[model samples]
Target: MVLAIAGIFIVFCSVILIAVSDRHPDATEGISSVPISIISPFQDAVTGSITFITGIWRHYFYLVSTAKENDELKKMLSQAVEKKNQCIEIELSNQRLRKFLDFQKTRMAQTVSAEVIGKDPSPWSKTVIIDKGRSDGIRKGCPVVVPDGITGQVVSVSTYYSKVLLIIDRNSAVDALVQRSRARGIIRGMSAEDCTFHYVLRKNDIRVGDEVISSGIDGVYPKGLRIGYVSGVIRRNSGIFQEVDVTPHVDFEKLEEVIVFITPAEYEFEMP
Candidate 1:
């Protein structure tokens, strides 16, 4: 009975060991496979989760870097555009200055270069303030001019600035003669854009489009300086003088720079 019981016990133990051990068709060693089999699904799930999180982090970092690069590129483009505009403005200014230099060579008298800094707000008067004054040799009655034609004469002066009475001012007048027929007339300001030729006789042979130039008798402007052009002419039998309308060559509203002629000492105080 004891021998039979021992054999039975040994058979039961062998069966249990075979159930837990690895099944091999040719290998001799037996490795436990139950633990690994149970844990494989969990391991795969953990690895997949880590891969997904790492991918999302990398994508977010790439997006942030791209946005920063785009901002920097936009700023660079804006700066380039601003610099281009500045270059264009500088070129335009240089062109204007060149014309002034060319005009300066034609003048026989000394001149002071000045910039128009302000204008009179009074509607009854047309005048501009220049940056040069007595300290710069500018004086009252000094003839102011531009490249186009005669501008005005200085009527007031300070140490560093001067006021120029434009030809369009109601109080302004110049002794002018028609360039075509040598007809003499007094160019008087009538409005902001028009001047009237007074003392022009009806038989003076004046006509529209005739240029009026200074006769130098006014003692303010130089001889042959352009004052304006005759725009209209009317004949009347009752009056000795004809109604003549003149238009000045200078564009008063667009005045930016001027040249003040440094006249002789005797002509400084002779205001026109």
Candidate 2:
């Protein structure tokens, strides 16, 4: 009974549609009994509506996914950059600590620690000023050294400031000995990168890479402090001495801080 009722309802709606189409013949122009032209338009409208709604949903989903990916990538890049800077800072601190330990082991006679606060700022002068001054027991002719070796001498001093004449200065001289061979010579500041060792007997045993250190005989610099490594040796033709060039241990271009050995007050000079 239910099927019979539904079939009757469908047939009744179809008849009404056919009567309406008959009243408007253009709506059924190509069909003989049914309005196919009207049927086509309705079917096309339903499909187009579905496609428009699906396109809108697809665009919305794409926008949301792209925003999330962009944020994630930016955060990753930020973390990488931060780690790079941290690594560089750690490496620099490690190098400084190693230098400090080396100085402690040497136990220089007596020492003053100071930071370089200023430079000549002129290409003509390689001078640097240290924070330690005369008030801090610093004076002219005081020896200065870094972990690797000698830097210069304190040439001028005020109550609150001291000027260091770098090993590259023209007027600086130091008595030094070759570490491996125990040969003695007078080293003078010759240039920005090295010094000249004079009064070396041509027959003396010297070679490249020999370490140079303070001789302590002058009572100015304590003996056995490193100065530089030998880089050049020139034998003169029938001359009394040979010329030697040494590369300083400390790099002035990268100089930062230094230690000065101050002899105990009782450590006075003995006249010959």
TM-score of each: 0.58, 0.57
Q: How would you encode candidate 1's per-residue C-alpha lDDT over 1-272 as one tens digit per residue? A: 99899999999988766664435311322222233234433544554576578878977868969788889999998999999999999878765675655533222588888877666767888987776777899877899989778898987666666778888887788888999999988888865698999999888898799999988788888878887888999998788889999999988888878989986323222112
Candidate 2 shows a clash count of 0
In lDDT terms, which candidate is top?
1
- Model 1 alpha-carbon drift over 4 Å, by segment: 1-107, 264-272
Each model's C-alpha lDDT? 0.77, 0.76
Alpha carbon lDDT of residue 104, candidate 1?
A: 31
- Name the 10 consecutive residues with the lowest summed lDDT in model 1: 24-33
TM-score of 2: 0.57
Model 2 bad stretches (over 4 Å): 1-108, 264-272
Q: What's each prediction's clash count?
A: 0, 0
lDDT of 2 by residue, 1-272 (tens): 99999999999999988898657634543342133223333434554576578778877768879788889989998998999899999878865775655532223267899877666757766777776766789866788889988888876665555678887776678988999988899988865678899898988999999999989786677777889999999987989899999988888987867997655223333222
Task: Quickly count the clashes in candidate 1.
Answer: 0
The lDDT of model 2 is: 0.76
Candidate 2 lDDT for residue 253: 84
